[model samples]
Target chain A: DVKVTQSSRYLVKRTGEKVFLECVQDMDHENMFWYRQDPGLGLRLIYFSYDVKMKEKGDIPEGYSVSREKKERFSLILESASTNQTSMYLCASSLQGALDTQYFGPGTRLTVL
Target chain B: TQLLEQSPQFLSIQEGENLTVYCNSSSVFSSLQWYRQEPGEGPVLLVTVVTGGEVKKLKRLTFQFGDARKDSSLHITAAQPGDTGLYLCAGPSNTGKLIFGQGTTLQVKP
Candidate 1:
Protein backbone atom coordinates (compact mmCIF):
# COMPACT_ATOMS: atom_id res chain seq x y z
CA ASP A 1 0.00 0.00 0.00
CA VAL A 2 1.09 3.60 -0.63
CA LYS A 3 1.59 5.82 2.35
CA VAL A 4 1.85 9.60 2.53
CA THR A 5 2.59 11.37 5.79
CA GLN A 6 2.34 15.01 6.73
CA SER A 7 4.48 16.76 9.33
CA SER A 8 1.71 18.16 11.50
CA ARG A 9 -1.90 17.23 11.91
CA TYR A 10 -2.71 20.67 13.26
CA LEU A 11 -0.78 23.94 13.41
CA VAL A 12 -1.29 27.48 14.60
CA LYS A 13 0.52 30.56 13.38
CA ARG A 14 0.32 34.30 13.73
CA THR A 15 -0.05 36.73 10.90
CA GLY A 16 3.11 37.39 8.88
CA GLU A 17 4.76 34.32 10.33
CA LYS A 18 6.37 31.78 8.11
CA VAL A 19 4.80 28.35 7.91
CA PHE A 20 6.07 25.13 6.50
CA LEU A 21 4.13 21.94 5.86
CA GLU A 22 6.06 18.84 5.02
CA CYS A 23 4.95 15.67 3.25
CA VAL A 24 6.72 12.40 2.70
CA GLN A 25 5.75 9.49 0.53
CA ASP A 26 7.18 5.98 0.44
CA MET A 27 6.02 4.97 -3.05
CA ASP A 28 8.84 6.66 -4.94
CA HIS A 29 6.32 8.43 -7.15
CA GLU A 30 7.56 11.09 -9.55
CA ASN A 31 4.70 13.53 -9.00
CA MET A 32 3.88 15.40 -5.81
CA PHE A 33 1.23 18.05 -5.23
CA TRP A 34 0.15 20.62 -2.66
CA TYR A 35 -3.46 21.65 -2.24
CA ARG A 36 -5.59 23.68 0.12
CA GLN A 37 -9.10 22.41 0.73
CA ASP A 38 -11.82 24.75 1.80
CA PRO A 39 -15.52 24.24 2.43
CA GLY A 40 -17.46 23.89 -0.81
CA LEU A 41 -14.37 24.71 -2.93
CA GLY A 42 -12.99 21.19 -2.67
CA LEU A 43 -9.28 20.58 -3.27
CA ARG A 44 -7.60 23.36 -5.17
CA LEU A 45 -4.09 22.66 -6.28
CA ILE A 46 -1.51 25.12 -5.04
CA TYR A 47 1.65 23.72 -6.50
CA PHE A 48 2.96 20.51 -7.96
CA SER A 49 6.38 19.04 -8.67
CA TYR A 50 6.87 16.57 -11.47
CA ASP A 51 10.47 15.88 -10.59
CA VAL A 52 12.97 16.84 -7.94
CA LYS A 53 13.51 20.63 -8.11
CA MET A 54 10.92 21.00 -10.84
CA LYS A 55 7.79 22.89 -9.84
CA GLU A 56 4.60 24.08 -11.52
CA LYS A 57 1.94 26.45 -10.32
CA GLY A 58 -1.58 25.18 -10.01
CA ASP A 59 -4.80 27.16 -10.03
CA ILE A 60 -4.25 28.90 -6.71
CA PRO A 61 -0.53 29.32 -6.16
CA GLU A 62 -0.54 32.78 -4.64
CA GLY A 63 1.26 33.06 -1.29
CA TYR A 64 2.34 29.44 -1.54
CA SER A 65 5.53 27.75 -2.70
CA VAL A 66 6.76 24.18 -2.77
CA SER A 67 10.12 22.42 -2.63
CA ARG A 68 11.01 18.96 -3.83
CA GLU A 69 14.57 18.14 -2.93
CA LYS A 70 14.05 14.38 -2.79
CA LYS A 71 11.65 12.05 -4.49
CA GLU A 72 10.09 11.07 -1.20
CA ARG A 73 9.71 14.55 0.25
CA PHE A 74 7.67 17.57 -0.80
CA SER A 75 7.38 20.70 1.30
CA LEU A 76 4.94 23.59 1.13
CA ILE A 77 6.05 27.02 2.27
CA LEU A 78 4.03 30.03 3.23
CA GLU A 79 6.31 33.07 3.31
CA SER A 80 3.91 35.05 5.50
CA ALA A 81 0.92 33.47 7.05
CA SER A 82 -2.35 35.34 7.01
CA THR A 83 -5.72 34.63 8.51
CA ASN A 84 -7.07 33.91 5.06
CA GLN A 85 -4.38 31.34 4.51
CA THR A 86 -5.81 29.06 7.15
CA SER A 87 -7.13 25.87 5.59
CA MET A 88 -6.64 22.14 5.35
CA TYR A 89 -3.39 21.42 3.53
CA LEU A 90 -3.01 18.15 1.71
CA CYS A 91 -0.04 16.60 -0.04
CA ALA A 92 -0.33 13.90 -2.67
CA SER A 93 2.04 11.82 -4.72
CA SER A 94 1.62 9.76 -7.87
CA LEU A 95 3.53 8.25 -10.73
CA GLN A 96 4.57 10.22 -13.84
CA GLY A 97 1.52 9.25 -15.86
CA ALA A 98 -1.61 11.33 -16.09
CA LEU A 99 -3.94 8.51 -15.14
CA ASP A 100 -1.96 7.49 -12.08
CA THR A 101 -3.85 7.53 -8.81
CA GLN A 102 -2.66 10.13 -6.31
CA TYR A 103 -2.12 9.01 -2.78
CA PHE A 104 -2.67 11.71 -0.17
CA GLY A 105 -1.63 12.37 3.40
CA PRO A 106 -3.87 12.86 6.40
CA GLY A 107 -3.68 16.61 5.93
CA THR A 108 -2.58 19.53 8.09
CA ARG A 109 -5.18 21.92 9.45
CA LEU A 110 -3.55 25.30 9.95
CA THR A 111 -5.22 28.04 11.92
CA VAL A 112 -3.88 31.57 11.48
CA LEU A 113 -4.59 34.17 14.05
CA THR B 1 -8.58 26.80 -17.86
CA GLN B 2 -10.43 23.52 -17.45
CA LEU B 3 -13.05 23.52 -14.70
CA LEU B 4 -15.32 20.83 -13.31
CA GLU B 5 -18.60 21.90 -11.78
CA GLN B 6 -20.33 19.60 -9.33
CA SER B 7 -23.97 19.92 -8.46
CA PRO B 8 -25.80 19.44 -5.16
CA GLN B 9 -22.91 20.87 -3.18
CA PHE B 10 -24.59 19.61 -0.04
CA LEU B 11 -26.95 16.71 0.56
CA SER B 12 -28.50 15.28 3.69
CA ILE B 13 -30.43 12.04 3.52
CA GLN B 14 -31.55 9.23 5.72
CA GLU B 15 -30.02 5.79 5.72
CA GLY B 16 -31.42 3.46 3.07
CA GLU B 17 -32.06 6.42 0.83
CA ASN B 18 -30.56 6.83 -2.62
CA LEU B 19 -28.72 9.84 -3.99
CA THR B 20 -26.87 10.92 -7.05
CA VAL B 21 -24.13 13.53 -7.56
CA TYR B 22 -23.30 15.12 -10.85
CA CYS B 23 -20.00 16.41 -12.23
CA ASN B 24 -19.99 18.40 -15.44
CA SER B 25 -17.31 20.07 -17.53
CA SER B 26 -17.24 21.88 -20.82
CA SER B 27 -13.88 20.54 -21.86
CA VAL B 28 -13.29 16.90 -22.68
CA PHE B 29 -11.16 14.82 -20.35
CA SER B 30 -8.83 11.97 -21.06
CA SER B 31 -9.80 10.41 -17.77
CA LEU B 32 -12.14 11.12 -14.86
CA GLN B 33 -12.01 10.00 -11.25
CA TRP B 34 -14.19 10.10 -8.15
CA TYR B 35 -12.90 10.39 -4.61
CA ARG B 36 -14.41 10.26 -1.16
CA GLN B 37 -12.86 12.23 1.68
CA GLU B 38 -13.61 12.00 5.35
CA PRO B 39 -12.87 14.57 8.00
CA GLY B 40 -9.12 15.18 8.57
CA GLU B 41 -8.23 12.83 5.75
CA GLY B 42 -7.43 13.37 2.12
CA PRO B 43 -9.68 12.19 -0.66
CA VAL B 44 -9.59 8.48 -1.54
CA LEU B 45 -10.10 7.24 -5.03
CA LEU B 46 -13.38 5.44 -5.48
CA VAL B 47 -13.44 4.92 -9.23
CA THR B 48 -11.87 6.04 -12.47
CA VAL B 49 -13.59 6.29 -15.85
CA VAL B 50 -11.39 6.57 -18.89
CA THR B 51 -13.56 5.70 -21.82
CA GLY B 52 -16.58 7.51 -23.12
CA GLY B 53 -19.89 6.14 -21.87
CA GLU B 54 -18.16 4.00 -19.33
CA VAL B 55 -19.93 2.61 -16.30
CA LYS B 56 -18.22 1.04 -13.33
CA LYS B 57 -19.68 -0.42 -10.19
CA LEU B 58 -18.19 -0.98 -6.76
CA LYS B 59 -20.62 -2.66 -4.42
CA ARG B 60 -23.45 -0.19 -3.84
CA LEU B 61 -21.75 2.65 -5.67
CA THR B 62 -22.08 3.23 -9.40
CA PHE B 63 -20.07 5.64 -11.55
CA GLN B 64 -20.92 6.65 -15.09
CA PHE B 65 -19.01 8.79 -17.55
CA GLY B 66 -20.80 10.74 -20.22
CA ASP B 67 -20.52 9.76 -23.82
CA ALA B 68 -18.95 13.13 -24.58
CA ARG B 69 -16.22 12.47 -22.03
CA LYS B 70 -17.01 15.76 -20.34
CA ASP B 71 -19.29 14.67 -17.53
CA SER B 72 -19.76 12.02 -14.90
CA SER B 73 -22.09 10.96 -12.13
CA LEU B 74 -21.93 9.01 -8.87
CA HIS B 75 -24.94 7.22 -7.46
CA ILE B 76 -25.23 5.60 -4.10
CA THR B 77 -27.88 3.01 -3.37
CA ALA B 78 -29.26 2.49 0.12
CA ALA B 79 -26.86 5.00 1.58
CA GLN B 80 -25.38 4.25 4.95
CA PRO B 81 -23.94 6.44 7.68
CA GLY B 82 -20.51 5.35 6.57
CA ASP B 83 -21.23 6.85 3.17
CA THR B 84 -21.23 10.36 4.58
CA GLY B 85 -18.32 12.37 3.35
CA LEU B 86 -17.16 14.81 0.71
CA TYR B 87 -17.48 13.45 -2.81
CA LEU B 88 -15.17 14.96 -5.37
CA CYS B 89 -14.76 14.48 -9.12
CA ALA B 90 -11.60 15.19 -11.02
CA GLY B 91 -10.28 14.97 -14.55
CA PRO B 92 -6.91 14.93 -16.22
CA SER B 93 -6.21 17.97 -18.32
CA ASN B 94 -4.30 18.25 -21.56
CA THR B 95 -1.17 19.17 -19.64
CA GLY B 96 -1.45 16.02 -17.54
CA LYS B 97 -2.68 18.07 -14.62
CA LEU B 98 -5.53 17.09 -12.37
CA ILE B 99 -8.49 19.41 -11.98
CA PHE B 100 -11.02 18.92 -9.22
CA GLY B 101 -14.56 20.10 -8.77
CA GLN B 102 -15.99 22.05 -5.84
CA GLY B 103 -17.14 18.78 -4.24
CA THR B 104 -20.40 17.48 -2.84
CA THR B 105 -20.81 17.02 0.89
CA LEU B 106 -23.08 14.07 1.65
CA GLN B 107 -24.58 13.43 5.03
CA VAL B 108 -26.32 10.16 5.75
CA LYS B 109 -28.21 10.10 9.01
CA PRO B 110 -28.55 6.80 10.72
Candidate 2:
Protein backbone atom coordinates (compact mmCIF):
# COMPACT_ATOMS: atom_id res chain seq x y z
CA ASP A 1 0.00 0.00 0.00
CA VAL A 2 1.10 3.54 -0.70
CA LYS A 3 1.81 5.55 2.43
CA VAL A 4 2.17 9.30 2.63
CA THR A 5 3.06 10.67 6.03
CA GLN A 6 3.35 14.25 7.23
CA SER A 7 5.64 15.55 9.93
CA SER A 8 2.79 16.89 11.95
CA ARG A 9 -0.95 16.44 12.15
CA TYR A 10 -1.38 19.81 13.86
CA LEU A 11 0.83 22.81 14.41
CA VAL A 12 0.71 26.17 16.15
CA LYS A 13 2.91 29.10 15.24
CA ARG A 14 3.16 32.74 16.08
CA THR A 15 2.99 35.49 13.53
CA GLY A 16 6.20 36.17 11.63
CA GLU A 17 7.63 32.81 12.70
CA LYS A 18 9.17 30.44 10.27
CA VAL A 19 7.31 27.19 9.73
CA PHE A 20 8.03 23.99 7.92
CA LEU A 21 5.72 21.16 6.88
CA GLU A 22 7.27 17.91 5.82
CA CYS A 23 5.90 15.07 3.74
CA VAL A 24 7.32 11.69 2.87
CA GLN A 25 6.03 9.04 0.56
CA ASP A 26 7.03 5.42 0.39
CA MET A 27 5.77 4.75 -3.13
CA ASP A 28 8.82 6.29 -4.82
CA HIS A 29 6.58 8.59 -6.80
CA GLU A 30 8.22 11.20 -8.97
CA ASN A 31 5.64 13.90 -8.43
CA MET A 32 4.81 15.64 -5.16
CA PHE A 33 2.50 18.55 -4.38
CA TRP A 34 1.53 20.95 -1.63
CA TYR A 35 -1.89 22.48 -1.29
CA ARG A 36 -3.92 24.52 1.17
CA GLN A 37 -7.59 23.73 1.58
CA ASP A 38 -10.09 26.29 2.79
CA PRO A 39 -13.80 26.26 3.19
CA GLY A 40 -15.56 26.90 -0.13
CA LEU A 41 -12.16 27.38 -1.76
CA GLY A 42 -11.33 23.70 -2.27
CA LEU A 43 -7.77 22.55 -2.59
CA ARG A 44 -5.54 25.22 -4.11
CA LEU A 45 -2.12 24.18 -5.21
CA ILE A 46 0.76 25.97 -3.54
CA TYR A 47 3.78 24.26 -5.01
CA PHE A 48 4.82 21.05 -6.69
CA SER A 49 8.01 19.17 -7.44
CA TYR A 50 8.43 16.86 -10.39
CA ASP A 51 11.91 15.68 -9.53
CA VAL A 52 14.70 16.29 -7.12
CA LYS A 53 15.67 19.99 -7.09
CA MET A 54 12.84 20.75 -9.52
CA LYS A 55 10.02 22.94 -8.34
CA GLU A 56 7.13 24.88 -9.86
CA LYS A 57 4.76 27.44 -8.51
CA GLY A 58 1.10 26.57 -8.46
CA ASP A 59 -1.86 28.93 -8.46
CA ILE A 60 -1.20 30.28 -4.95
CA PRO A 61 2.49 30.13 -4.16
CA GLU A 62 2.90 33.45 -2.44
CA GLY A 63 4.76 33.41 0.90
CA TYR A 64 5.58 29.75 0.40
CA SER A 65 8.54 27.82 -0.90
CA VAL A 66 9.30 24.15 -1.45
CA SER A 67 12.31 21.87 -1.20
CA ARG A 68 12.78 18.51 -2.83
CA GLU A 69 16.30 17.43 -1.98
CA LYS A 70 15.28 13.77 -2.21
CA LYS A 71 12.70 11.75 -4.04
CA GLU A 72 10.82 10.55 -0.99
CA ARG A 73 10.70 13.81 0.91
CA PHE A 74 9.11 17.17 0.13
CA SER A 75 9.05 20.12 2.44
CA LEU A 76 6.94 23.28 2.39
CA ILE A 77 8.41 26.38 3.99
CA LEU A 78 6.69 29.53 5.05
CA GLU A 79 9.06 32.50 4.95
CA SER A 80 7.22 34.17 7.81
CA ALA A 81 3.96 32.79 8.95
CA SER A 82 1.01 35.12 9.26
CA THR A 83 -2.47 34.69 10.65
CA ASN A 84 -3.80 34.46 7.13
CA GLN A 85 -1.53 31.51 6.52
CA THR A 86 -3.45 29.32 8.92
CA SER A 87 -4.95 26.51 6.92
CA MET A 88 -5.12 22.78 6.45
CA TYR A 89 -2.07 21.85 4.42
CA LEU A 90 -2.06 18.68 2.39
CA CYS A 91 0.76 16.81 0.68
CA ALA A 92 0.25 14.41 -2.17
CA SER A 93 2.41 12.23 -4.38
CA SER A 94 1.84 10.45 -7.66
CA LEU A 95 3.73 8.44 -10.20
CA GLN A 96 5.29 10.07 -13.29
CA GLY A 97 2.15 10.45 -15.31
CA ALA A 98 -0.35 13.17 -16.03
CA LEU A 99 -3.32 11.00 -15.12
CA ASP A 100 -1.84 9.03 -12.25
CA THR A 101 -3.56 8.73 -8.92
CA GLN A 102 -2.31 11.09 -6.21
CA TYR A 103 -2.03 9.64 -2.74
CA PHE A 104 -2.40 12.23 0.01
CA GLY A 105 -1.25 12.48 3.57
CA PRO A 106 -3.57 12.97 6.49
CA GLY A 107 -2.93 16.75 6.34
CA THR A 108 -1.58 19.25 8.83
CA ARG A 109 -3.83 21.87 10.31
CA LEU A 110 -1.64 24.88 10.95
CA THR A 111 -2.73 27.66 13.21
CA VAL A 112 -0.86 30.94 12.91
CA LEU A 113 -1.72 33.19 15.77
CA THR B 1 -6.68 28.06 -17.16
CA GLN B 2 -8.45 24.78 -16.73
CA LEU B 3 -11.23 24.89 -14.17
CA LEU B 4 -13.67 22.39 -12.65
CA GLU B 5 -16.99 23.59 -11.29
CA GLN B 6 -18.94 21.35 -8.90
CA SER B 7 -22.60 21.89 -8.29
CA PRO B 8 -24.71 21.62 -5.13
CA GLN B 9 -22.13 22.69 -2.64
CA PHE B 10 -24.03 20.99 0.11
CA LEU B 11 -26.50 18.18 0.50
CA SER B 12 -28.28 16.64 3.48
CA ILE B 13 -30.19 13.43 3.07
CA GLN B 14 -31.49 10.60 5.15
CA GLU B 15 -30.31 7.01 4.99
CA GLY B 16 -31.52 4.98 2.01
CA GLU B 17 -31.91 8.17 -0.06
CA ASN B 18 -30.44 8.69 -3.48
CA LEU B 19 -28.34 11.70 -4.55
CA THR B 20 -26.23 12.91 -7.39
CA VAL B 21 -23.44 15.48 -7.64
CA TYR B 22 -22.26 17.14 -10.82
CA CYS B 23 -18.92 18.45 -11.95
CA ASN B 24 -18.70 20.68 -15.01
CA SER B 25 -15.98 22.38 -16.99
CA SER B 26 -15.74 24.52 -20.10
CA SER B 27 -12.31 23.17 -20.92
CA VAL B 28 -11.91 19.69 -22.31
CA PHE B 29 -9.93 17.16 -20.30
CA SER B 30 -8.32 13.86 -21.09
CA SER B 31 -9.49 12.47 -17.78
CA LEU B 32 -11.39 13.26 -14.61
CA GLN B 33 -11.20 11.88 -11.07
CA TRP B 34 -13.52 11.75 -8.11
CA TYR B 35 -12.42 11.76 -4.47
CA ARG B 36 -14.12 11.35 -1.14
CA GLN B 37 -12.81 13.14 1.94
CA GLU B 38 -13.84 12.47 5.46
CA PRO B 39 -13.51 15.12 8.12
CA GLY B 40 -9.92 15.83 9.15
CA GLU B 41 -8.51 13.56 6.46
CA GLY B 42 -7.10 14.11 3.03
CA PRO B 43 -9.17 13.35 -0.02
CA VAL B 44 -8.93 9.77 -1.27
CA LEU B 45 -9.35 8.83 -4.90
CA LEU B 46 -12.63 7.10 -5.50
CA VAL B 47 -12.67 6.66 -9.24
CA THR B 48 -11.21 7.98 -12.46
CA VAL B 49 -12.89 8.25 -15.85
CA VAL B 50 -10.82 8.52 -18.99
CA THR B 51 -13.01 7.98 -22.02
CA GLY B 52 -15.86 10.17 -23.03
CA GLY B 53 -19.38 8.84 -22.50
CA GLU B 54 -18.06 6.27 -20.11
CA VAL B 55 -19.68 5.01 -16.94
CA LYS B 56 -18.15 3.07 -14.08
CA LYS B 57 -19.73 1.62 -10.98
CA LEU B 58 -18.24 0.90 -7.57
CA LYS B 59 -20.65 -0.78 -5.23
CA ARG B 60 -23.56 1.63 -4.84
CA LEU B 61 -21.73 4.53 -6.43
CA THR B 62 -21.83 5.27 -10.17
CA PHE B 63 -19.63 7.69 -12.08
CA GLN B 64 -20.24 9.03 -15.56
CA PHE B 65 -18.10 11.09 -17.85
CA GLY B 66 -19.67 13.33 -20.42
CA ASP B 67 -19.42 12.64 -24.12
CA ALA B 68 -17.45 15.82 -24.66
CA ARG B 69 -15.00 14.91 -21.89
CA LYS B 70 -15.82 18.20 -20.21
CA ASP B 71 -18.04 17.03 -17.39
CA SER B 72 -18.79 14.22 -14.95
CA SER B 73 -21.30 13.16 -12.35
CA LEU B 74 -21.45 10.91 -9.24
CA HIS B 75 -24.58 9.20 -8.12
CA ILE B 76 -25.11 7.27 -4.92
CA THR B 77 -27.88 4.80 -4.25
CA ALA B 78 -29.23 4.27 -0.75
CA ALA B 79 -26.76 6.52 0.92
CA GLN B 80 -25.87 5.75 4.50
CA PRO B 81 -24.30 7.67 7.34
CA GLY B 82 -21.01 6.08 6.42
CA ASP B 83 -21.24 7.87 3.08
CA THR B 84 -21.20 11.31 4.63
CA GLY B 85 -18.18 13.19 3.43
CA LEU B 86 -16.95 15.78 0.96
CA TYR B 87 -16.90 14.75 -2.68
CA LEU B 88 -14.37 16.43 -4.94
CA CYS B 89 -13.76 16.37 -8.68
CA ALA B 90 -10.45 17.10 -10.32
CA GLY B 91 -8.84 17.17 -13.75
CA PRO B 92 -5.31 17.48 -14.93
CA SER B 93 -4.11 20.76 -16.43
CA ASN B 94 -1.69 21.03 -19.32
CA THR B 95 1.12 21.33 -16.79
CA GLY B 96 0.21 17.97 -15.25
CA LYS B 97 -1.04 19.68 -12.12
CA LEU B 98 -4.60 19.04 -11.07
CA ILE B 99 -7.40 21.59 -10.94
CA PHE B 100 -9.89 20.77 -8.22
CA GLY B 101 -13.48 21.78 -7.75
CA GLN B 102 -14.81 23.39 -4.59
CA GLY B 103 -16.38 20.05 -3.63
CA THR B 104 -19.78 18.88 -2.50
CA THR B 105 -20.27 18.25 1.22
CA LEU B 106 -22.77 15.48 1.70
CA GLN B 107 -24.25 14.75 5.10
CA VAL B 108 -26.27 11.59 5.43
CA LYS B 109 -28.31 11.14 8.56
CA PRO B 110 -29.15 7.81 10.05
lDDT of candidate 1 at residue B67, scale 0 to 100: 98
- Model 1 misplaced stretches (Cα beyond 4 Å): none
Model 2 docking category: medium
Instruction: Write model 1 residue lDDT over A1-113, tens digit each, in one string.
Output: 99999999999999999999999999889999998998878788899988999999988999988889998999999999999999999999998653589899999999999
Docking class of 1: medium
lDDT of each: 0.92, 0.95
Over 4 Å off, model 2: none
> What does DockQ give for each predicted structure?
0.76, 0.77
Chain B TM-score for the candidates in order: 0.97, 0.98
Compared with the true structure, what per-residue lDDT tens digits does model 2 show for residues A14-93? 99999999999999999999999998989999999889999999999999999999999999999999999999999999
Error of 1 at A85 (Å): 0.7
Q: List the per-model TM-score of the A chain.
A: 0.97, 0.97
lDDT of 1 at B101: 95
